[model samples]
Target: MSGVFQRISSIWREFCKRRAYGALIHPDGIAAQAEELARLADLALRSTAALSALECRHLAQLAQSMRQLRETAHSPEFCRLSADRRLALHRQLLTAREKLLASLQKTQISTEKLQ
Candidate 1:
């Protein structure tokens, strides 16, 4: 039937997209990792401790990856997701932002004790 063919086509297209854009496909996991990285960055900035050379290099690498994610968000490939998936990504981003903000407060509290 034509309907069955269309469903199969859709599935194939989605699979291809997922393969091609693996980073953007799992927005929930990506958002969580981003939030955690941001929290660590915040802690580093707030703490009196100095960062080792390796830690600085790692943060530089993370900055480049974050920039790639920003660029990908503007690409047509990022728009290929279904509306529900896009909405879920948006919601996850918002949740991640809130968590990052909460983490900043905790980091501040702990760092203040060290000062």
Candidate 2:
């Protein structure tokens, strides 16, 4: 029974790894993620009230990352990039997107509380 459980866990890990790789490296995947991240950042910047110093810095960093991701992923040189490089960029975009979302939610919650 223990052996069976170990096998299942191993299989699950492999599946997740492959899925993550494929999803990020597929033809349209990287570009789409970059666009989504940009949209989120824009929304957060436009809708939020006064941000903290840390939030402002984070938002600046996220904007820079989004621009870099867009340029790299869409460049003619992108096709020559290694799978690892593309995957890393995709991960960065995803992380930025999540952070922007969280920031936006926090701002909204605070605004509501003040109301």
Best by TM-score: 2
- Give the per-residue Cα lDDT of candidate 1 at 58: 59
| lDDT of the structure predicted as candidate 1 | 0.58
In the range 52-77, model 1's lDDT, one tens digit per residue, is: 57755655565455545555655677
How do the predictions measure up, each by TM-score?
Answer: 0.43, 0.60
Looking at candidate 1, the ten consecutive residues that score lowest on lDDT are 106-115
Residue pairs clashing in model 2 are none
The clash number for model 1 is 0
- What are the Cα lDDT values of the candidates? 0.58, 0.70
Q: How do the residues 1-115 of candidate 2 rate in per-residue lDDT, one tens digit apiece?
A: 9999999987787566557687677536887787677777666766677777777677667766766766676677886665666777777767766766775766753345544
